[model samples]
Target: MNQNLPCTEPRPIPAAKKVTRRRSPISLIWIVPLVAVLIGIGLAVSAILQRGPEIELQFASGDGLDVHKTKLKYKEVAIGTVTAIALSEDHHSVKVSVQMDKRAAPLLAGDSRFWVVRPRVAAGGVSGLNTLLSGAYIALDPGKSRNVKRAFVGLESPPLVIGDMPGRQFVLGADDLGSLDVGAPVYYRHIPVGRVVGYVMRPDGKGVDVRIFVDEPYDHFVTTATRFWHASGIDLSVGADGMKLEMQSLLSVVAGGVAFGGGDASNGEAPVASRFTLFSDQTTALRQPDSIVQKYVLVFNESVRGLTVGAPVDFRGISAGEVSRIDIDFNRRASDVAMAVEISLYPERFARQQRNRPTALPTQQGLRQILDGMVAKGFRGQLRTGNLLTGQRYVALDFFPKAKAAPIGWNRPIPELPTQPGSLDSLQEKLVAVVDTLQGTLQRVDRLIAHVDQEVVPEVAPTLRDARQTLARANAVLSSDAPVQMELRDTLREVERAAASVRDLADTLEQQPQSVLTGKKASK
Candidate 1:
């Protein structure tokens, strides 16, 4: 075992040396985190620097809106997002903050409008139905104004004419709204061509002012001479002329609509903000204007049961005027009640047919003279049954040559026209008179019958009884099964036999005259 002690003396341990490790400025382990932090900082700066502007929207409600989810869109393009929602200072509305993209900043202006789009059914039609499934969203209608805006009041309803819809607005003066509503259709020749935008009660509260917009090409049809009327429902009229039914369209019947048309004369294009009158119906709207109207009152001592406002005042079956007002007044002086009927005569309507018309438009002296002459000739106004079914009556003017003469009163504000009982009234009077005469005659006949029953009937009673007995006996003799009838039948048979015998004798004489003289001639 060569385990002999080798050089057991360990060499001197190497002296300790200073080893200074070169220190790198940055450690490789930290490099990754540093780069990461730097990238994060850069992204944050970009988000702050490139951010868009923010605006506030005031809405009556916060319905169907979600923070960070609701979006504002224009032409179906998303442009902004709802960031915050809070109640307004007055607690009357919900104020929403929207962060709009820088690209959409240019579209924000004072006149820009915003509204929540949802399923809505209006008179015009159903709209915003697509929003039912996709959820309600804010809709933006960019304005033409250039003024910048930071806050805006949201619209409760979507605009009827959104964006730059090519149209022109017109004003209509109406006695009342009459079923008209915003977004109602405007019709031309039964076709929808526009929409009602607004309606306002007049400042004086006397009527309504309706605003409507007509599309570009259809606007051309609206001229100075065009007539506007309510075409809201079916017009069914029955009168002396008979039944008349007029309809515009099925849509117009349900939604309420305005219709326009022109006469042969359509002068020029109506101005941008032109104003027109809204008549009750197409017939009234298109009728020629009555420039010369003369009003007159008629006093009648008889009943005016079937008379009504708008009843036609006919001149020999031709329409000349209409009843305007019917009133009743007490007369303390005469102590008699009478009906006061005010009628308007369109003198110009008849004047158009005259061979010579008045030279000027103002004065009506010539008309007065003509009416005076007519009155002198026994011409007067009378109430007559125009329609038997409806019991409608109308004023009729005709010449009554046999009637008593009456004078016209031309001094009052509304001239007084002489009136006479209607033909029906006269007929009723005649019938009543005839009935009275018949009643008197019947009374006299009744008295005669009573006298006969008391005196003459008693005296003739026995004679009448005897005559009845004789008639009874004659009836008994005439009976089929009586003895007299049987005896008569026997006599008739005997007569027949005798006649036969005479014929036989005559025949024998013709054959042999000698045999007739002979006693008898025996047959074989």
Candidate 2:
């Protein structure tokens, strides 16, 4: 019984000896580690909150983009930074990762435009020159639309005009694209007011269409009758007015440019998207459109050698129109070849202008009536020399009162205008006749001269020899002092005295015709 109790008591005593461990306030050292862990978590959250969104931008080249170094700028203010650079999947472009500032997040829109800004020279002169010292950067242009976007494709070149510029866009149709270039200056009276933004070939393959932008105040000057011309390079023209040199500016001369002016501004501005013709030069652009052109066919009986498509068709001394076409046709009835000249005539050139009258002429039927009257008045077309040195010819329409009458038939495809021989041709014919007459006269004169040389010359020589021999015989007789010569001298003296008396009497009669009939009276 004592052993069992002792075992129980010892267990109870052993349990008491095991000290009770109490959890004391956590140690300050432990608190330090926990606070540190909490601080680390707070810092991580702050970092997450501050980091900006990453966006992908594709570019034609990575020329000026640099990871961590290149920046995206708007109005010269940094808005984002490039973080990475990589080749696109197709390897045709460069993929750039940009970290855009939170403030710039709204700018990442579908219509937003971006381009790398580096030192470059363009028709507008040196651009992005500031980038040379500060290194390259990406330029951003905000869009007007509200559509949001993340991925973007950058432009290879900067836009001609930046965001929402106040201007008007006009399309100019031209036969060819001359010296015009992107960013080329557009001048108004030598003042830079706009720029050439783009150009494209027409779908019909007929011509090129140039797109231009004119600034606000300048756009107002463009009217329905406005003219546009290529003003690039130095315009050197040598014409009847003498040498003329024209240029918009030195920059225009070097790069290329355009000019617009000459319009009926009194009618107000030109409607937007109005199609206008682009001329090669200012002279062509400034030509007046003051008349309606009527087509006519001229059947010429003479050569059309110097006549060209653009030859001037004149009425009297004034230009009425231009030559359109020239062709040869066979006259089946007459079995002869005839030359047909198609001409466009503007009746306004010769028609008397009434005071305050409209510039445009009447309709086709009215023109036909006028032409018919003119034909009855002996109106005829003839080719005439325009420039003697260049051998250029023009059609001259004139009235020939004495010419053979010929009627213009209304049944022809084109109204036929009668033609007469040109002045030059008539002059040539007269000259040929005169040359024939001169040749005949020259032949007769040559025959006369030959006759004189063969007959008259020989007779003259024999007569001269006989006279000389007679003179020699008289001289020999006088020098020898022969008795017969003395007797002849005495006889000559007596005859001379008698001749003197007759000469004195003739002188008296010559003084007065009546001296022979009446005795001369002496004056006191």
Candidate 3:
């Protein structure tokens, strides 16, 4: 009965076709779109969380750095990206914020350093041009320290204030542009170590406060006894060596560099302060006149024809140093003009190289002896023209080692150099003396000529005319015949014999003047 009823009830529907059911439109419109949107948002959130924390760094310069466009690199691989850029409160520096990849977090330490890589011009060479085009990056030089919460500074340019570990301190000063101004180099066996710090006028204006720098091992290497001198540029000179000086860079004209070294503490007992100042500018404005003491000396039988205040005080023509100051002394004791020259010599320039050799030789006495011997041994002083147009003069010392040597003492009289006329004054005096003597001699000669023409010539002319007339009359009388000719021949022979005898007598008188004089005196 139930089957019959179902059949009947469905009979009306079975006469048509089977119906297909459709899903809800609301689910297709809202739920599927929601699921896709959720997936995208979840992916974005996960990516952001995985990227990790960002760091902020401050910098004094950003010359080679870029924000967002530049990356932070470690081990030559990019590890972070610059996220933002802003100015610091002081406005003197730039603050850069960097977002590091999560994978790189462990690599960073508290002591990690960040410096800007930029183009640098140095005496050794120039560097960092490739980085300029790529934009400057944060260069991470991780340190050995183990602190977890770390901070770092991003540099825009190289640091003006250099750092050195625990050792000596080389305080360097700089100009506004940060260029160094010094005459010499900080060298280690001719190798460069540091640069000249700019100089300042001392408070009292008596001197300059110079600054220099030394890094680590080199700082320790340059001990208290270290010596500094100008090795910046070529100081060419034409002398025994023909040319002397250093010529390295075109930039040396406006700027200079330094070098250092020799040996460790090889220098004999260092001074208490261990600091020394070197100067190359010899202008009076840069010097303290009273800082140096000069003594009055009487140079008896000695003359400095070519010596000057800046002359090289040489020992055997090898320059030990220069004559710093000079003065003239009126010798009340000896009634002569004396010269006193103060000289400062440096053994360090050469001594540093030979530090390991032996005891430092006594420079004062040894150099004195060498100088004394040189002067006595025909070592002559002469003036040399340094610059023709400027008329700047320098001193030259030449020696003949074979000449006689002289003795020297503490206040010993400087031996006279071989004299040679060089100065304008000396030359003019000689010319005047020569001209005066020549004029006097010419006047005397003219007077003698006039006397001969007016007195001697006239008197001798009348006598000579009379003798010629007498000879002509005698010749006319003797023109007669054979007897005259024979007589003339005999007379000629006698005349010849008399002339020979006169010549012999004159020769005897000339040969034995003393005998002739004695005979003449006796006759008188």
Candidate 4:
């Protein structure tokens, strides 16, 4: 085959056409890097969308706080975190920047409250114990308003009573602060039902205004007649009735507290913020105001040593009045001083005792007439010892049937009430009079003794001498060996012999009753 084809001159072999292929926009190897870039961009956008609101909180101090670790808790659940802390423009406080989660956005009301929760010691008690282990953090007590706010002023301490708590608030007007302070407990029937929230000086600066909170269920106990008093320290009162001790609790005794009661719960519940007077004690709070007071002056002619101002003026063992003042005056009829005691008589006391009471108490003029009639009927005033140990005395209004009649001095500036000597004074006067009579009797006894010694003794001496002489003679006659004795003995023997002869004759006559008008009875 090669010898025949060689004559063609070995034509050159045609070259193969060059092949051109279009490439894809991306290579398989480059697709891996593009996917990674897309994932990174998506992550960055997600982070931007998840960002939260930032708020500034001005605080007095940055105590127990870290830049980024501190958290804001609502009911122990973290809702936000502290991002930054720096000094305020005024340099007086620290400004804290907080980033709040979107979920907690609704809680940022205009009235929302913010405070630092640390281990706190207050009048209420030790709180924030959990913070000791978890470290200090910010706490939130949301407001009820719909308005929202961002920047807020942080409180140095937690509020004693949270606003959202189920309770009612009331204002109390007080004369002084005493031991009462924020967190002081409020008691009803010795049970803790509320707490003191705050206090401030009055605008007049004459007193203080205290705010208190009472929890639900117990708030219904407050009524128009509700009475409040400071149950502080030991409520100890020693009076004529003896000693009384009342305390709500041990904490009340130490830190002080407020107690309210003695009102009928059936009455209308006092509205929140109702004004009430804060009494110093329960007694004063519960005491009914005395109306229809009648003042009278009692002039006493006896010593009022034990009687003092403020002494009770009791009538029939019931207190009707009190001694308001005491004054000394020269007695017109006697050489000693007299006492003028002014008394404040509450006529309502007598009216309350009447089983069939009148619509109203007696008028002043009618009261005077009544008093005048009573005085005519022997009504009198006297001082009686109330306590022997304390020597305290009280005025006693009583009827004295035998007391001399004395009319009231109506013409004087102050009407005078007739008064008799005090019970103790009467006894003292009786002792004095008895002693005087005894002294006079003793003088008479002395006179009698002197008269007997001077007048009767001389005459009695002579008579005694004569009696002695007569007794001596009688003694001589009675002597056993005297001649008179011998004669008397002989006469006695003669009489005995005659007596024997008579007795023998009587016996013979009796034997012969018929022989000699009846001889003596026969010997048998």
For each candidate in the order shown, give its overall lDDT on alpha carbons.
0.89, 0.85, 0.58, 0.87
Best first by lDDT, ranked:
1, 4, 2, 3
Q: What is the TM-score of each candidate against the true structure?
A: 0.79, 0.73, 0.48, 0.71
In model 4, where is the ten-residue run with the lowest total lDDT? 515-524
Q: Is candidate 3 or candidate 4 better by TM-score?
A: 4
lDDT of candidate model 4 versus the reference: 0.87
Count clashing residue pairs per candidate: 0, 0, 15, 14
lDDT of 1 at 258: 94
TM-score, prediction 3: 0.48
lDDT digits (tens) for residues 31-74 of candidate 2: 88999999999998876676667788899899967889999999
Q: Please identify model 2 stretches exceeding 4 Å from their true place.
A: 1-51, 234-254, 271-274, 290-292, 347-352, 356-369, 445-524
lDDT, candidate 2, equals 0.85
The 10 consecutive residues of candidate 1 with the worst lDDT sum are: 358-367
lDDT per residue, candidate 4, 1-524, as tens digits? 67666465677999999999999988899888999999989987875566568889999999998988999999889989999999999999999999888778888988889999999887788999998999999999999888888999988889876767887889888899889988999999889999999899999999988899999989889898898899887898755434578888999977899999877867789998887888999987887779567788998877677777767899998888899999987766777777889999888888888899999877779977988999999999988888777677888999998889999888878788898888887788899999999999999999999999999998799999999999999999999989999999999999999999999888766666575764345555
Which digits, one per residue and each the tens of the lDDT, describe model 1 over residues 234-326? Answer: 878877555678878887778788999984334888988899999998878988888778899998888999888998899976789899999
Top model number, lDDT:
1
